[model samples]
Target: MSTPDQPAAFKPPANDPWKGFRGVCSGTLILESIVVFLAIPAIAKLGEGVGAGAVVYLVVLGVVMILACGVQSRPWAMGLNLGLQVALIAGWFVHPAVGAMGLLFAAVWVYMLYLRKDIQARIERGLLPGQRD
Candidate 1:
């Protein structure tokens, strides 16, 4: 279908995209956990003052995020990840900064989901180079 003046679209070698996807998800969770941990100082200094409850909540949530990374390959993992996002957004009650961070990361996750869908579509359509030959 390509004209002499026009090159065909590039198709990467077919491979297990989900492997890299899991890695990306894990990395994102780790980074989000770091950001959540970093928000502790802000919460302590700026908000109603870091009470024991706030500290515990943030620390626990960060730990949960880290732990969630380990289960990224599970069927329930996406639901769990989405649930964590809701929990993070709920942190607004603790501090607006925490909620804002949640919103930011939520956007990132949404984009990731969109890309996942696209990849799945490509696989189904045999668009990958490995699929071609």
Candidate 2:
């Protein structure tokens, strides 16, 4: 309630929630890249000796994941991330451990997407803290 001469207090607009989400996605990619790199030693020793081509493939995929981190804000970034997951799973040809790692990360991505949808629904309902009157 305000008097005729008194103005209502000012409230700043809500922050862009997706900004933090992008950071999380970037960090996850970096972690995934490290894991992919670490799998190299296992690939060489545990399996029937990894081929030079297979090693090169893993290295390139890891590097691509790191590079993808820089573009997390783009609209197509999610598509690229999902594509990489598929590539990792396809690593079945190279080694089963690599494929298992991909499956684990894919589950993580599914959960992240579910959280994204929940946030969007909250925003639409004006249920976020900043949206309150």
Regions more than 4 Å wrong, model 2: 1-13
Alpha carbon lDDT of each predicted model: 0.87, 0.88
Residue pairs whose backbone atoms clash in candidate 1: none
Q: Tens-digit lDDT track for model 2 on 1-133?
A: 5578985454442887788889999999999999999999978899488999899999999999999999998999988999999999999889999999999999988888887898788777667778667
Against the true structure, candidate 1 reaches a TM-score of 0.86
Give the per-residue Cα lDDT of candidate 2 at 109: 88
lDDT of 1 by residue, 2-28 (tens): 589976555565687788888999999
**Span of ten consecutive residues with least summed lDDT in model 1:** 7-16
TM-score computed on alpha carbons, candidate 2:
0.87
Superposed by TM-score, candidate 1 places the C-alpha of residue 95 at a distance from the truth, in angstroms, of 0.6
Error of 1 at 55 (Å): 0.8
Best by TM-score: 2
